[model samples]
Target: MYHDCTQVLDSDATTYPDDPPVELAPHTTFEKDGYRVTELGFGTHSGTHIDAPSHTEPDGRTLDSFPIETFVFDAVLVDCRGKAAREPIDRTDLPKSTGGDLLVFHTGWDAHWGTDAYFDHPYLSAEAARWCADNGYHVAIDALNVDPTPTEGAGDVSGNAKDKPEGVPAHHALLGTDHLIVENLTNLDGLPEQFTLDAFPLSVSDADGSPVRAVAEFQP
Candidate 1:
């Protein structure tokens, strides 16, 4: 069975501060043209998306740097639910051994999507992120960011000048190397611990990141 783990991108979709929101316009209508086509406009990191190394590292690899097969992963899902708002998921929360190349965290924060509380979802600690990177495990989370997102009036969306770790420590730790990070995943309630993840990003040249249709497959 296959499960869709991607979030829907629409006008009401939650987005990071300053990032562009989803925009749709009718390019052609049945009454105006023979065919109907809609114009789409949004940032690369709009919804369920992958963050390539270039997103944090200026000279790091982008989405176009890897082969298509790289997007497919043998995944392990980590249940980190019931966590407090803006809490950090430490190394202790992660499994030491996993027969997979990817680690997906189910934070249960996707239930708060499109709300201010979603920004306060649980995040991965810098130590945990580095652990994953060192262990050669790609990471994904069912939250807005792998790092803590700033509150509306707390600071900028990048989490500058806040109680949290300065800058994006989780991002730099993981993306600083060759690993990838996927964020804003949804519909992970009943997935098996082990599964196959197919999350292919758009093939954009020198792209920092791109939206992905992340999917999970496993035998019932």
Candidate 2:
């Protein structure tokens, strides 16, 4: 069966404070034009989205640079429930024998989707980021970021890894290695330990990121 792991986008969707406000004005209404069309507008990273390497790296690959096959993969869920704010998920905590190219973190932070609490939820340890890079895994998180949010408490710093005082290094870590990063995911709790993931980003030329309709397929 196929499960929609994507977060439903609407007016109340949570977003980074810096992102543009989402707008869905009617371009044409059935009453006036006998058709329905919307003028959609939002930031590249506005909703459940993917971050390409160019999101941080100066000469990194953009969304259109990678082959479409890179977005679809087998996946394993990493349970991080009850992990504390800014808590780093060490590489040691990851599954020893994961079954796929994607590793998704289920932190249960989607519970706090529209509040300040969501922004400060647990993040991936710097080591975990490097682990994904080293192992060639596509990573997705239910939290606002794979790393810490601005103003959140610092977690365990990786050895000599330059820690950003106001940001987590996961973005730079994954993007720097040409790894993919998906954020603001929801409905991950219903997923099994292993599944099929098809996360395709918009083919926006030269863009750094795009909202994705992430889905999970698995046998029931």
Candidate 3:
């Protein structure tokens, strides 16, 4: 069995405030004596998306350069719900002997999707991203990000006022290592605490990221 990880993009779908919102345009209407056709415009990272290394690394590989095999692999789930903000999940959080190349985090943040709480949610720490990088965990979180708010600061430090003030250390740690970062996943709570995950994105050439259709499967 499989569960879709892709978000249904609509007028209400969440996106980076700086990016242009998703919009649908009709190129040819069925009633206009033509075939049904539509044009979609949105940021690459608009929904349940995968961030390629190039998303953060200037010299990193693009989505088209990624090997097809990279999209298919074994996976392990690490559930860290109820954990403190910006918790660092080291090797201990993972299975003792996971054979899969992919590591997925189930933080139960999907419940807050479409709400302001979702954007303000906590994320994995830089150390957690480092751990995944060092251990060869190909993919990362399904939550907002992997950084926390600044512990000591009166004014916003990061340029983006809407983003967390902790900076993009998580992006640097994970994306810097050429690991794929999947964000804004939902329905992870329905999955078992531990299971196999499969995630794939559209093979868009030269794209920094693309919405993925991720899924988890386990024997009942």
Candidate 4:
């Protein structure tokens, strides 16, 4: 059985407060032209998208640089919604021997999508990020960001800090030469502990990130 783990990309959909709002223009409506076609516009990281190392690291490889095999792998899901807002989840939350498995963290933050609370969701600890990297696990999460909401720039965040560090410690910790981060995932509650994860990005040349149709298929 396969569970779709992607968010709907639309004008009304919730997006990271810092990213551009999704927009579309139909240039080929049947009323005017032959058929219907749309020109979509949104930030690369908008909606259910995967972040490449280049998203954080200046010298990191872009999404197009990764081999096709890196986008498919066995994965394990962890429930850590019990973690508090504005706090890091404890490293003990992860299973041992995560080697070669994608780790998808279900924070249940998707419940807050389209609300003020979405911006204040909990995040992975820098230590946890490092642990995943150290154990060779590519990471994905169902949160607006892997890092805590930024200190500034995101508008109307409940606890916007004037001095919130611009630094994304968790992103920095998790991103490597070929790291993958899938943000704003939903429907995680129905997935089994183990599944086959396929999260391939568009081959936009030198793209920092791309929207992904992420999914999980469990064994019978």
Candidate 5:
């Protein structure tokens, strides 16, 4: 069976504050051109997307630099649900054995999509991220970011890792190790513990990141 874990990309889609919002305009109508053509505009990291090392690390590898096969990964779901807002998912929250190369953290935060609470969803601790990186596991999460996303309210601290304010240590820990990150993933609750993740980014030249049609495949 195949399950689509990607979020829909429309005008109402949640986007990073600093990124361009999604736009869809009628370029040609059926009445005039006998066919419809819509013009699309959105940032690379607009919706359910993958982030390359260059997204944070200077002089790091871009999405296009990776081989096509890199998009498909054996993934294991990590259930980190019931966490409070702005809480950190520490190393203790992870299982000792994943049996996969990708760790898909299910925070159940997708339930708050399109709301302010979504930004306050649980985030991965830098130690947890480093643990995954050290074990050569890529990371994916059902939240805005692996690190805490500071909103208008509450504290801005992500985790107990040092260098908290200078940069997103969780991002640095994973990306600095050349591990890719997938964000805004949904429908993880419907998936089994193990599945095949197929999320291919756009082939844009020197792309830092790109929206993906992330899918999960597994036996029913």
Candidate 6:
């Protein structure tokens, strides 16, 4: 059986500070004697989503441009649970078992969901991001943005400094490559330390990103 690793998107789901929060409007309701339907008004990158190359790279591929095979691949999990604020995930933090096409980081940070702590959690370093890109890993993440938090004197304006360093090293290192990234994952704690991860985004043409329904299956 497969256990879901994606976070459920709801009106109350936590969103990035600058991103618009999810909104649900009723187009029709079954209780109102109409078709059971609802219209969602939110960003494409909302909730447990995959960021395509186009999301950060100017000439990168969009949601529909990715091959089906990119969505299905062998995966491994890396647990980085007890790090303090602003700590970067370097090469040594990863486990030896992680040699798959996909790498999922189970930081146990998802427990901070809906609070300010989640948004300000630790993230990957530029070296780590570069390592993944150079080594051919497809995905990476914790529960928050990969960029560091902006310091008081820093000239950065992306509002990612809370989790990253002076510059957006992680983004440049990771998204600069062809690898896709999955962010804001939850329920990873229930999964085994290692498992087969299956994460695929919706095939929305021209979309820079899409929310994914990710899952993991492990054999005892």
What is candidate 2's TM-score against the reference? 0.90
The better-scoring model by lDDT among 5 and 6 is 5
Across residues 30-137, which tens digit of lDDT does each residue of candidate 4 receive?
999879999998999988899988999999888887898888978888888787666567698888655446888889998888876777777877788888877778
- Candidate 3 residue-wise lDDT, 94-164, digit = tens: 56664667777777777767775555555666676787777777665656555553433212333344444
Show model 2 residue runs off by greater than 4 Å: 151-165
Per-residue lDDT tens digits for candidate 6, residues 1-116, read 68888887889888866678888888888879557777787787788888887887888878788778678757777778876655677878765554778778777878888875
- Model 3: how far residue 78 lies from native, Å: 1.2
TM-score between candidate 6 and the true structure: 0.87
| Residue-pair clashes per candidate | 0, 0, 0, 0, 0, 11
Model 4 residue 24 CA deviation (Å) reads: 1.9
Q: What is the lDDT of residue 30 in candidate 6?
A: 80
lDDT of predicted model 2: 0.83
Q: At residue 124, what lDDT does model 1 achieve?
A: 89
Off by over 4 Å in 3: 84-98, 148-164
For candidate 4, the per-residue lDDT at 35 reads 95
lDDT of 1 by residue, 20-136 (tens): 989888999999898899999999898999999989898989889888999999999999996777778999999977678999999999999999878878898999999999999
lDDT of 2 at 146: 87
The segments of candidate 6 whose C-alpha lies over 4 angstroms from its true place after superposition are 96-98, 149-167
Taking all chains together, each candidate's TM-score versus the true structure is: 0.94, 0.90, 0.82, 0.90, 0.94, 0.87
Error of 4 at 181 (Å): 1.3
Flag regions of model 1 displaced more than 4 Å.
Answer: 153-162
lDDT of each: 0.89, 0.83, 0.69, 0.80, 0.89, 0.74
4 versus 5: better TM-score goes to:
5
What is the lDDT for 173 in model 2? 82
